[model samples]
Target: MLEVAVIVLAVFSVLLAAACGWLILSQRHLAALQAERDAVRDQRLKELSKRLDTYLTGSVRMGEELYELRRVVAPLPDKLTQIEQRDPSSLSFTQAARLAGMGASVDDLTQSCGLSKAEAELVSKLHHAQHPTS
Candidate 1:
């Protein structure tokens, strides 16, 4: 009866050791899982921050471009009124000369600046001769 008791005691001790080892291994696994979660969270935060910065920079650039466009367009109405009310015939020769320098076609010169067909053709030829393309 004493030997049987000793055998049972030994078996119990072995079972306890196995349970302790399992517990230790489970704790280690849990720690590793927590560390992995932390790393993933950090990476996601960095990526989101970078994306937000890029978005802000683009928005600022777009706002600046809008401001510049407004500045350029602010005087367009006044200039249009002046052009509409001016005597076209008075400035026809000068306007034709400038348009020819800017690569205007003969038809455009004749229509916009009231040049005759022959005069427009002469201006186109002279301007083209001055700034010839290869």
Candidate 2:
């Protein structure tokens, strides 16, 4: 009876040791998988940052070009007034008529030829009557 009890205890000990070993191996595998996932995520984040930096650089260049364009166009309104003042009624109406034929808005004619909005609209209407579009 004592020998039988000793044998049972030994078998139980062997099974307990095997279970501990399996648990240790599973924990190590889980840790390795988590580490790999973290590395992949870090790589993707770096790639996205690079793309954002490139887009920001392009936006800066476009902003600079727009600033230069504004500088170039700053004196245009004054120059236009000077020319219209020198030429008087004939040149402005001719210009307005041409612009009206080309689909200029009333505001465009008012700004470009110094005409009132009513006059610009009248010219636009006359031009449209002379040449109807399809």
Best by TM-score: 2
The TM-score measured for candidate 1 stands at: 0.57
Candidate 2 minimal-lDDT segment of 10 residues:
75-84
The lDDT values for all models are 0.77, 0.79
Off by over 4 Å in 1: 2-6, 88-134
TM per candidate: 0.57, 0.64
Task: Kindly report which residue stretches of model 2 are placed more than 4 angstroms away from their true locations once superposed.
Answer: 93-134
1-96: candidate 2 lDDT, tens digit per residue? 999999999999999999999999999999999999999999999999999999999999999997986675565445445645666756876788
Candidate 1: 10-residue stretch with minimal lDDT? 76-85
Q: How big is the positional error of residue 51 in model 1, measured in Å on the Cα after superposition?
A: 2.1
TM-score of 2: 0.64
